[model samples]
Target: MVPLKKYPNYSSWAFLAVMAVGALFCSTVIAGVTGQFNLAPVGIFCGLLWVIGGALCFWAVQAEQDLAGTGLRSMSVSILLSFFSGVVIFQEPTLLYFSVPAIACMVIGIWIPASKTKSVWKNWRSLLSGAIFGTYLIPYKFSSLGDMEFLFPFSVGVCVGSVLLVAIMTLKRKKSFGYPKIPTLFAFASGILWMLGTLAIFWAIADDGMFGYAVGYPLLQLNLVVNQMWGVFVFGEYASRHGRIKLTLSTIVILVGAVLLTLSKM
Candidate 1:
């Protein structure tokens, strides 16, 4: 476990590097499999990854107060991995100039440290979560199943995987399946929002060809901006003026990168 301290040490850097590598490898393998496999098995398998990824995301937010920056870093990693997998395995076309610059901008932007006490393990967990989240659409693009058809099994897999994980976690923690009403309501609301957003993606992809997927992928990454706002304004992730400036500049870079990526696909 990485100790939350004034600055990350060499061991901290090592942990982050190893975790990032592992996350990247997992994403690449998933992408490769997605490009070649049928949706039946792939959807099930990918759903399981999502559950693991979701858990990592939870851990990440719990470990750090700068929720937005953490989310952005993870998303930035996914952006690069997604583009690579799309082109290599799925034969998607991309202009080198735009794509390379976009990736560079995102990486540089995310490199600006978000918190004083960054936990390497938690940060890497977020990266792994983003990696898994990034693979959500890869299999769907290759599947012959209709949008709704694929969504059904995929959704089922997600539910099953989530329930199993939650149950196991609860058992290990010796906790009851109970929560505060307000938080539970908010969680439900978020679930609804997620479902709607997902359905929209499915519809867009089904209607607009791979072009839609490519375009939507980067646009959705704009959520990083929102997360940052929540971090700064709502969560007060950065109190110092200098830190806030760094976060702002990083957000701009990330947006620019996202736009460039979108244009590259078009």
Candidate 2:
């Protein structure tokens, strides 16, 4: 794979294509090995939602180039929606005293970094992406199929949706598809990594697992801390003193909220 410096020049379509291909391959192999090919309608819908949400997230990342900020925005929304799903849809009991303030902290934390970016449209993309991601799992919760069983249909949706999106965008732009080898390899690797993470989350939320959607979902949002570390140490994002301060404060607040959410499960 090419160095990260070459990323800006690579075609997004090619990136999406290779990533989807990689994820599709992993999902197909997993489903085949597990012999769990039950294609519930809700599973298909969940897959479609994942593709669209993932595309939006990629777009937002391209636009902002600030992993921490985009991650915070999207994951914040995901956390909020998952909390709502837990309480309302699943009837999971949450201590309102903890959850209400947790939500407030997350909302405020998400808002703090908004002023860092000039493009409101980019922020909207992140929010919309997160919203879709948050709700996509709801369909999976409704599906009768087991987590591994649903992966095949969901991966198929991802591939199909990605292809359609690429085709539409290519036609609109009147450009031939460009496949840079290094970027394609990196993208493919990313997809594989994503599939692994998805599997972990699926198990976490499965009925047989340790944590249900309410608890497991929010727990995953702790990735925001890792995102921030990459942004600060690797990318040199939030270089300004003021920006650093805001980022620190917001991260602390977000962590507090996440911790509170976990405790609410207790």
Candidate 3:
């Protein structure tokens, strides 16, 4: 496949904005779906949405995309909207006081800059992707599927959708059907990790309902910290003294926010 066009002057701010917007949309869906959880096969629709979101999000992160910025933005949005909806829409009356601080910290943390960038289209794609991913859990949560039952069919849907996307991409690029052994193995490993995370969340909600969301969602945002570490140490993102300080403070704040969000469950 031909390489994408090069941008003579890439704008980090623009890229971050687009990525954050995508994250916001994705988080909105997550909150909305989980708030409306029920026992039906509707998880298939959520799975499809998640597949779309994942495609767009990865598209933004492709080829030198700032993992830290994109991840932080996505998590910030998810943290805020997830709780806001829990309190307002889902009527989690107990969460209001604690959620205020959590939301505040997320707002402050996400605003801190993290990386430079190169593509507007990539950001847009990420935005759409994040929005869809945020919603995939709703149907299964609402469904009467036992923990394992929800895990099986929803996971199947996600896998099938993802495989179809891969097939479509291969066809579009006219790439030969071959996977590098190491990369395929790594991908399988990643798949296992993702499945484990999904199962953990499903189990939480299955056990506790909306209260599960109160705690689990914030825990999920902890990925922001991990992603930032990868960005700073592995990818050399936000390497400058100023950027490092920002990221450090952001991490602290995000942690506090997560704590507050978890406390809301109390």
What's the CA RMSD for each of the models? 9.8, 2.6, 9.1
Across 1-266, the per-residue lDDT of candidate 1 in tens digits comes to 11112122212222222333333333334445555323476556655666677666655665653477668767876666666666676766677688778878877787775555655565687878778777767777776666555554555456567666666766877764544444443444444455556556667555355544544565566777777776678656777899889988988887788778777777
Residue 246 deviation, candidate 3, in Å?
0.6
By lDDT, the best candidate is 2
lDDT of 3 by residue, 1-266 (tens): 00111221222222222322333333334445665333235655655566676655555555435677667656655665555545555455556678787778866876666444544344555445544444456565456666655554455455556666666766777764444444344444455555566656676655455456545655676776887787688667787899999888888887788788778778
Q: Assess each prediction's global lDDT (C-alpha) against the native.
A: 0.60, 0.77, 0.57
| lDDT score for residue 176 of model 3 | 41
- Model with the higher TM-score, candidate 2 or 3: 2
Q: So what's the TM-score on candidate 2? A: 0.89
Which regions in candidate 1 have their CA more than 4 angstroms from the true location? 1-42, 113-122, 203-215
* Candidate order (TM-score): 2, 1, 3
- 64-161 in candidate 2: lDDT tens per residue? 66677788788888988987897789877667798778777876876676674376664798889889878788878876778888788887778778
Give the lDDT of residue 52 in candidate 3: 70
Model 3, CA-based lDDT: 0.57
User: Which 10 consecutive positions of candidate 2 have the poorest summed lDDT?
Assistant: 1-10
